[model samples]
Target: MTGPLHEQSVLVVGRAGGIAHAVAVAARDAGARVIAAGRHRQRLADLYAGEPDIAAEAVDLTDEGSITALASRLGSLDHVVSTASARARGRLGDLAGDAVRLSFDTKVIGPLLLAKHLSPRMRQDGSFTLFSGVAASKITVGTLAVAITNGAAEVLARSLALELAPLRVNAVSPGVIDTGAWDALGDQAKAQYFADIGARNPARRIGTPHDVANTVLFAMTSTFLTGATLPVDGGEPLT
Candidate 1:
């Protein structure tokens, strides 16, 4: 899986588990050499310890120096998928300014910086896929911060598509996916939560990490696609 990507080197930046983990495996299966990058070194290594085809690297989005160094180290890549995000939740009036800045740093500014530095080293046919969320469109009292930041990701993707030109840029917005991202809720609560959400969805089921990861694959491999946000939310927005 890790031998020269067989296709192109795919750099997936985010935590070593959950959706990022799924994406890495999907990329490797799709014949791309997969480099799983994130801020946590141990987690990154642990995520791919036995996977010879997948590599791991450490990179932080908040630090420009870190990202710049990573960009230089990568030299060239065919696809870059940033699934890194700061989990956000708070009412509009209750959130702190610093929290807002950090949210944007992770979701919006980070990807912009990636395009700024990494785009230069990307192949003409390469693409950048960002992870947005259904929250970008479905705003609630508690998801105000997440909504704004995710909305910004969509905007950033569109603008980057135009600015980056030959290198395509797009975003994938997922709904309630059973990716273990909600494992903190414990098994019973998590199951109940997903079941509740699933019942309301038109698909009558919660999404899997593969659903979103598959979308990432399309964004990078489809030569004609660009500047679009593909929703893997299964009618969450429509509902």
Candidate 2:
């Protein structure tokens, strides 16, 4: 089970499923102790109950106090990957102020607070891997809120990389991954959407959770790579 992260402690922040869960599994397999934290502690705990190497905890990214508490509880960590996001989809006219605010609060400000509180406890070589998305680069019509939030997240990563110094900071921007995130479209529609994206994108297929997870693992181990937004979008932005 030993790998690049052997014996290190990794914290993954997000829900029980999707890309965050994939990252946690990858980190654990890489021989790191994984703490899966999110707003719902019990659910995450239940999800990873069988894994001795993965522990589940609670932290609300929107609340700085919660982030502080989690940092205090953990004391020290080797790496952190944040995949939490609240998407505010739809055109400008259909967007709600609250939804847009929640998107920024969850994706951007939350990660900033995590860095503020967690960086002190991290090793000088440890890194932070935040999640961005293709929306930031592609700039489509129905995803204005998502694009702006993701763009801000990239900037935040770069700024943190400089401000945090020896502690590295980076981002993973995924494209149309076939996760539950698209389940809202229902089975039939989701399939069609994936087909359309797969055909249009250079990779000619939708991304998998592992596609993004592998990148996060690389970010954690690749000390030289910092302040960069690595895309796991199957080259979607190019097309």
Candidate 3:
């Protein structure tokens, strides 16, 4: 008899990010065929170069045509994981119309389009996992776009879960994972920032990409878990 995740085909969006890489590796390790999608061709190519079990595709989530094209390539899927998000950090009033549109398009509209195109192709036992951030719950200045998008994504996941039913749909809200996205920050600033937040968190440390990845894998395999927003934030929400 096959294991729970064996022989399943999983499609992962935003495959260039650290968390997506971790999830791809974990899904592959669990005997699933992983198809990683993103807008960065070289990054996706580099990621799949050494991994025969993993495949990579270049996709722009902001374009519905691109998403539909990707769906065509996928044909059928047992799981879909979206780690895509727009990182245009700015104050509420300072954001340009295009910037706001880009942010909303990638975070909210992109996943919705993916679901619209892929839902019919997904197996009844299949599942979808979308990524949100702790900013949705935590009040942070200059993160209005992110917070709004995260909140909307979570709500969309819940609604889709209800509609999809037997096909589980969920979102993972992560906090302060040490990914390369923070490499641009000054060392002192980064250290102080994480140190302060970690101290407040009940787990007393920042989460890792693997931490979030494992939670996503759990959502994929969990037959009974649906419409749940799992916070893989090292208990930061408790603070």
For every candidate in turn, the CA RMSD to the true structure comes to 1.9, 0.8, 1.6
Per-residue alpha-carbon lDDT of candidate 1 for residues 1-239, written as tens digits (9 for 90 to 100): 33334668899999878889989998998888888999997899986999866898889998889999998788689999999988667887788888888889998899889888999998998999998899988877889889989999999999999999989999999999887778899999999998888999899999998988888988888889999999999899887
> Which regions of candidate 3 fall more than 4 Å away from where they truly are?
1-3
Which structure among the candidates has the greatest lDDT? 2
lDDT of each model, Cα atoms only? 0.89, 0.94, 0.88
Instruction: Write down the TM-score of every candidate.
Output: 0.95, 0.98, 0.95
Q: 1-239, model 3: which lDDT tens digit per residue?
A: 14557899999888576899999888988889989999996899786898967899878989999988888877789999999877768897887778778878988899999999999999999999988889889868998888888898899999999998888999999998998777778898889888998899999987889998899989999899999899988877667
TM-score of 1: 0.95
TM-score (C-alpha) between model 2 and the true structure:
0.98
lDDT of 1: 0.89
Candidate 3 has an lDDT of 0.88
Q: Which ten residues in a row have the lowest lDDT in candidate 2?
A: 176-185
> Which residue pairs does candidate 2 place in steric collision?
none
Candidate 3: Cα lDDT at 189: 88
